[model samples]
Target: AQTVTQSQPEMSVQEAETVTLSCTYDTSENNYYLFWYKQPPSRQMILVIRQEAYKQQNATENRFSVNFQKAAKSFSLKISDSQLGDTAMYFCAFTGRGSTLGRLYFGRGTQLTVWP
Candidate 1:
């Protein structure tokens, strides 16, 4: 059983600043995938970033990046140059390969508010 945990329940940041949301997981499998999904007030789950366990380097996408520590089972997300539109509920998710294609285990959630 793989479980993701986001210690921060809520985080706020000023526009154009940077913020990092912490996430940790417990997984016995050596190979798996981690993801960060954002759901705005509209409540649509959007993929923010993803990191494969085998990849040593972190993954970055525009204003979003991830600090993936496979050994520690931690995958935190960093949002740089934040904007008001970034306000949303961020969820950390994990999925094991093989038989778990449609299955995704998510953390409680982290509500991020970007203030102008």
Candidate 2:
């Protein structure tokens, strides 16, 4: 049973600034995938970033990046140059590689609000 945890219930950041959301997970499997999904007011889940357990280097997408610590079972999302559109609920998710595809276990989520 893999479980994701986001300690921060809510976070606010000023526009054009940077914000980092913390996430941790507990998984016994050696190989798995971690993801950060953002759901705006529209309620659509969008992939922010992803990191593979085998990879040591973090993943980066535009202004979004991840701090992946495999040994600690921690994966955090860093949003740089935050924008008003970035305001949403960010969820940390995890899934196993085999037999359980597309079934993601998500955290309670951190509500992020970007102020202008």
> Which lDDT tens digits does candidate 2 get at residues 25-59?
98778888999999999999999899988999999
Name the runs in model 2 displaced over 4 angstroms.
98-102
As a TM-score, model 2 comes out at 0.95
- Pairs with steric clashes in candidate 2: none
**lDDT score, candidate 1, position 13:** 97
Question: Global lDDT for candidate 1?
Answer: 0.93
lDDT of 1 by residue, 1-116 (tens): 66789999999999999999999998777778999999999999999999999999999999999999888889999999999999999999999875555689999999999999
Regions of model 1 farther than 4 Å from truth:
98-101
